[model samples]
Target: MTEASREVGVVLRRRPVDNPWIDHLWSPAMILDEVPATAPWTVLSTQADATIYYAGPASIELFSSDTANYRDNLADGEPRIWVALRRQDGGSELELTKVTVDPTEGEAMFESGCDVIGTVPMPPEIAAWIAAFVDEFHVERVFHKRKRDRAPGDRRGIPDEGKRRT
Candidate 1:
């Protein structure tokens, strides 16, 4: 199946936490529709409590099969783009893994063992892009109810020794 992709930049925040076990908390802060010229993992801002970093460019992929989910997402008052970050083995603390507009796929990311996953408000431009794709390729699927069996049947259709059907 043909798919659409958009290149965008992801911003992450590292915040000093009060927890005893962990030193800092990392999360996706926002997404830039246009990838900035700065290098990946570059620190953009630093504050007393939190620091923002450009996690680098990630692609938001769109499949025609998933346009239904995307449409549902846009219907919500606050559209969101889900970002997922994983902990690197030894190179970097965190790596930008995925950015998606499909809500079902986004929800599935929570089940992943990634270090950080979050939803950021969908930028107007990105939302419009998705809307246009959905409008062009979305196909409505009609649901049909299946008829139930007339009566309960034997397990595996096995014939009983005492009562066998001719």
Candidate 2:
């Protein structure tokens, strides 16, 4: 467990949905502080609404540049860990793609339209771990707004406005 990275086990839930095109929906169910002896993709449990499977292990990577995002997450009343699962080609199996504590990186994962991305409550153990990293690496950035350089008369990018050039 180094300062820059931490490994955690993830379990995913496959809930049956009413949608005719899909059989089930995949989402991160929970994160485990301890790596379970259970095999990846092995069914852990089944309930009326969903079935849980071990989605294997993932690493939460921290960067000194990203400490601000981590701090914001810690300040959030309900801190969450972002999890992403990628499909195993055109099949039902899901691969645990990424796990992250930084909110900015987490939201960026959603830009990939094909992956199953979701957030799970940040485990207390993991939250403390991230908080420790932030305390050590967080650097306060002073925002310095820069004035745009432009000719005073130039209001638009167009060379000439309101008149057509014949």
Top of the candidates by TM-score? 1
Cα error, residue 32 of model 1, in Å, equals 0.4
Worst 10 residues of 2 by lDDT: 153-162
Model 2 / residue 125 / CA error / Å: 0.8
Residue pairs with backbone atoms closer than 3 Å in model 1 (clashes): none
Clashes counted in candidate 1 amount to 0
**What are the per-residue Cα lDDT tens digits for candidate 2 across 1-166?**
2258777899989999999899889989899987888888889999999999988888888888888898899899889999987778868667787888888888999997546999999999988988888898788989999987898877676666568778
Which residue segments of model 1 deviate by more than 4 Å?
A: 90-92, 148-166
Which is the leading candidate under lDDT? 1
Give the TM-scores of the predictions, in the order they appear: 0.87, 0.85
Clashing pairs counted in every model = 0, 0
Q: How many backbone clashes does candidate 2 have?
A: 0
